[model samples]
Target: MTTPPDWSKEEKAVQAVQMAFDLSNDIQRAFRVSAALQDMSTSDMVRKVLQLPYQKNRARPRLTITLKDEDFELLAEKYGLDPLDRATIRHRVSEDLRAFAGNYLTES
Candidate 1:
């Protein structure tokens, strides 16, 4: 099978240690939504908000979000894509972020 054109292979490093916060639901949702609208992952968003140095030239430059089976089902239905096609679902989500940012700019 041919690799999808949108997918790129990258050399990955050992996983970095992750830090998670236990924010109130409202706060977490607000933070996550704000980042999504800006086409940033929460990690990058937090780094920017805290005035930390931006890490450049990442091995893989991509946004990530944890999704449950229900989310995949919902998003697949929303995008009219097959539920089993995770790669396509991911591409659709990235497209959605761009669309959200575009709409947000006109509204602002």
Candidate 2:
């Protein structure tokens, strides 16, 4: 607004109306924000808005118990487990295989 008031009266009126509209929007936002703060502190709103990170629970180690065909079939019957041969087991449950070998293997 440092520029001279050289414009005609209509432009001045339009500028005043736009400033009024901006002020109204700011006032309305302030009221809504004030009401929310009255119900709960601003810190509470921030904490709720910014979610805390999720923490993972510690899980027990997995073990592989190889079952004989009949026993495996019995396990399959009892727990509804699909039969898995050693090679298939090695491929499917690769994570447990190393731990199982580590626990039972003789060092070469």
Candidate with the greatest TM-score versus the true structure = 1
> What do the candidate models score in CA lDDT, each in turn?
0.77, 0.51
Off by over 4 Å in 2: 1-62, 81-108
* Number of the predicted model whose lDDT against the real structure is largest: 1
TM-score of 2: 0.18
- For every model shown, what is its TM-score relative to the native structure? 0.43, 0.18
lDDT of 2 by residue, 1-108 (tens): 588767788777877532223347676566548535445443333334556332222133344466678765654454444665445444545644566768865882
lDDT of 1 at 11: 23
In model 1, which regions exceed 4 Å deviation?
Answer: 1-61, 104-108
Candidate 2 local lDDT, residue 69: 80
lDDT, candidate 1, 1-108, per-residue tens: 977664233322334456888889998888788777776766777887889865433446565689999999999999998999999999889888988879757563
